[model samples]
Target: MIKWLEIDGQSSVAVARRFARTVATAAGFPEVRTEEAVIVVSELASNIVKYAGCGRMLVQWMPHARGYRLAIVASDKGPGIGDLALMMKDRQSSGGSAGIGLGAVKRLSDRFDIHSTPDGGTIVACEFLAPGLGLHPSIELAGLFLAHPDEDICGDRWQAWEMPHGLRLALVDGMGHGPQAAEAAGTIIDMLESHARLPPSEALGNVMRDYRNIRGGVASVADIDASRGEIGYANIGNIASMRLRPGEIKRFPTRNGFVGNRSAEPLAEAAAAGRGDYLIFHSDGLKAVGADMLLPLHGHNCLLMAAWLLENGEVLKDDVTIVIARVHGRRTHAENG
Candidate 1:
């Protein structure tokens, strides 16, 4: 489950920390690890209170090869950090204290990332693993999903897993808002997870077959083969899928129909996506006019790029979801050995 907290003032810091601690403990984190997570949350919330006046925090569970990890993400619309490198120094204070907050967060997290622009806002994401699970290199993926204002559940959902061939991904946007929409989208996600071993087209067909009679949704699935530098994708309805390579952005084709109610066969398309290429899948809730803004973020970390798009993209009055995957270059002989 994903939880959200608003950090509006000093009191909100304690609230955010408590929320993080509760989530960590419930996720089976050890007491010591839970304490570390609380500290990280405290520091991040404090930063927002001191520098940004107000911000938001998202806490969720992230799956890894060994098990699950805690993912804490903090975002603020305040004046962005001007010098990220300087701010990361142990003693360099942007808010006049000892300034160890961010440095400590980086040290405590198994995976850490931060992105900020002078005028654009700042987003910090950290992932904490259970004890004895050392870091391992995996395919890069990041996604964001938000419900429409005044809604408790988001109708849009995304999921990805590393397969033996490479990575398989799915993005779904239900027909409308609220509980029914969430159920439709979530059911599609469950189907995708269960039938992940099938090819994209076949997997989607299976989902559609089982999803008949339910509220319909638009969906896209992709199989990324990093070893072969290729991607196989299929989509039904309006979910947008795109491939970004050097100097070009190729939008994949999608058939017009609903997944559960009625749909045409979506032929899987193959395309080259070498190292440094990015594959993006997003629901129609993202405005078409703002789609071009993704060009400049081509080479950045997937998490940072996703956050930036979520922050700047025009979100309609519906649930929105965006998923990004980037292919890493071939490993060196020394690293492989």
Candidate 2:
């Protein structure tokens, strides 16, 4: 079971603290554990208000196969960090006053992941594992998944998905670049993620409603029934997508329109135009990696190939991110097993 709580406003810190205490008691966590969670949440939530004027907090508790897991996400589509590296350093301060707020957030969580783009926004995630539980080594072997940057404002973003329905997927490239661009990208991605189980077309429509909140953006949603060898999809804007099988690469075309504005055509109309074998998504960064190289990988290796192309290919000056998912084992049994 997944429990979700979203809180907003200046009192987000207080709300997070109260929620943490409630989660702790319900989950049977120690008092100290609850306090630590609340403190970290407060610090981050406070940063949201100070920096972004407004922010959002999402807290989720779910049962992992190994044990229970807690996730805290705080996001603000505001002026992004100019120097994320320095900001993360324990002694560094953006305003010249030193405080261990972010550092404390790091120390308190079992696993931490942060992504920020100069033009895009920022996403900070904290994962708390039940004491004494261990993560599967195989999961770590995949490394921390990250998107490749494109030239200037590359509006693309992606995340891997595994679901009961099959291998679900998404690719979103916000309308433009910078803070607004990031907001669009994040909004689209978040919507698809929320309805990952729905058909690609249906999920796309759901996200379309929120696109206005970000100004405008383009997105594609796809899901592969690996057992059935079928992949369904919907797309809009210039965000390009493809499917790579063992030796063949297939491209999905996009219909024109910015995300935030409803053109003469409906958002679903663009989505209704389905295309993809498996699926690969790219912002304008596709020009960097030759279109020919898109489908070289046989299975899971596709992700690595995409990463290599983004890093080595000259076409990127903006943020570049590509996602490739296969209905069948993209890797050999021997390789994955």
Candidate 3:
């Protein structure tokens, strides 16, 4: 599960620390890693309140080759650092800049990355790895999700699996907010997990036949067959799916109806996929705006790209989620051989 928090004052530091520890522990982090997570989260939140005056963070237990780990992504619109290299020095900012904890945060995280610009802002991503995971897929993927400010639970859910052919990614949005919506969205996630062997359209067909106790919602699913170098896609309702190439984007079409209902026949189609292509899917919570245009900035890090899009493109009062899957060539196969 992912939790999003806004740091507006010193009060937020404790809350962020608690959230990190609670979620990290739930994700099976060892006692040592959980304490490290708490310390890192506190430092990040304190620096935001002390330097930026205000900022936001997205914390999630994310999937990794090593295991499900805690990922902290913090960003702010405050004065952006002009020199990131200088900021990474071991010295503190002495209460005048935004680089107070960069060196320490870097040291604490297993993986860390940052992007700062004078015109835009700064985004810092830190990841901590656990000890185990089940799948070792060739391609890399990540997603970020949050509930509406007015709601307690998110109504959007997603899941991905390393299929025999390649990767299968699915996202579904419930009809509305609150418990019922969360249940509806969850139904589809469970369905996707159970129906992993089926193709997108057929699996969705199974959902239509067997779904129960939940209001209908939109859904989109994609199967990327790296061996064939193509993607098979299917969608229903308002979820947006796009194939993001380096300089161009091709949006996949969706039928106009709710997914669990007698909606439209979920037709599946195929398209060529390059080694570096990114296939993205999101609910109506995020508009299909210019996320395509910013590919140059957030393209290399799918987790950061997902976080950036959710933070910037959210439609104000709805649940939002985005999944990013980058197609890597036959690297896993080659490594095994």
Candidate 4:
């Protein structure tokens, strides 16, 4: 379960102390480790007040087969860190500009990762391993999309895959919005990643069969070939996929058909393509407008753009999601690409 906590100032300090005691007692950590945990909480809570005005925190303790582990996440929709280096350099910000709080927190934790956008706010996550515990590294990506503000449901889903084939991207947006409409879009993502390498059409067929049990979902799947400049893509329904090419806005739109329920089969054959593809998939949230309107924006800035678009009521009201895959050599670029 997830516990949501909101606090500011000395109250935040007191609450962190109490919460640390509770979690430490339940997990039976050594007094030294417990004190470290408390300090971690205090630093995080204090930073919330000094930076984001106020913030929300979440704590989750999951019991392992051997013991237990803790995860903490603090988030705020405030102006994000514009200069990560200045924020980390300790005493680097001009005057008494609240730099120590973040620098200290960074040094106190075992593992930490922060996601921030000039427009979308920020999320800081830390994971603590109890004595004698260990965890493998993991990767997570989340995308959200909404339809035209006037529309009810947004058609899109984001999924993660870890396999020998590397990471795969799957997104689905149903035809419309409502519980049923959302279910439809969600199901496409569900079926595609259920197996290692099932043909996209077969996955859609299976999802359609299952749709009888639930509503249906529309989806698109792209195999990201990180080594080569290529991506494999397949789509069904009104959802669209595109790659931001060097000088072109290439679009791959699936034919019309409700996934699962199968309103038509002629359009259900999978659409597959080769490399050099900057894959983009969306429902009607995008018209003929291509990535030319989008590619110039920095990758991190793209999400901020998404958040702003959602806030300003420019796109459809339905949920909206955008995924960009830049096929590069095996090296990973940490600059939010």
Tell me how many clashing residue pairs each candidate has.
0, 19, 0, 28
Local accuracy of candidate 1 as per-residue lDDT tens digits, 1-337: 3325788997888888888889899988899999999888888888888888898887766544345667787889889888788788765778788546677788887778897777767889887886665543435776767777778888887777668857888888889877888888888888888887888998888887777646888899998777766688988889988987656778888888878754466557878767777888888878762436877776776666666666677778778777888877464232211
Model 3 ranges off by over 4 Å: 1-3, 63-67, 89-100, 134-137, 291-293, 330-337
| Model 1 vs. true fold: TM | 0.88
lDDT of 4 by residue, 1-337 (tens): 1224676677866786688768876787888877777776776666667767787665555332234556566677778888876666544542365445556656665656566678757666565668886532221222334444444544455665544433466666665565556665565565665753655555555666556535565667666545432445666666666665445565665766666555554233322223333455555665544443555433432223333323333354355555444433344332122
Better of 3 and 4 by TM-score: 3
Choose the strongest candidate by lDDT: 1
Candidates, ranked, lDDT: 1, 3, 2, 4
Candidate number that wins on TM-score, 2 or 3: 3
1-337: candidate 2 lDDT, tens digit per residue: 1112234565656877788668766777787887887777777777776666675665655333255656676666667788877788764666664445576787898766565556545556676666666643222111112223332333455554665535555667665555666677877777777877677777776666555583677676666554344556677777676655445555666777755665423233221111223355666645634445554434333333443444335554454455544333333222211
Please, what is the TM-score per model?
0.88, 0.48, 0.87, 0.55
- Deviation of model 2 at 121, angstroms: 34
Error of 2 at 155 (Å): 4.7
The superposed Cα distance between candidate 1 and the true structure at residue 128, in angstroms, equals 2.8
Model 4's alpha-carbon lDDT is 0.55
| Predicted candidate 3 versus true structure: per-residue lDDT over 225-325, tens digit per residue | 87767788988788889888776777888888776676457767777777777888888877775844456653566777777776667365788888888
The alpha-carbon lDDT assigned to residue 272 of candidate 4 equals: 25
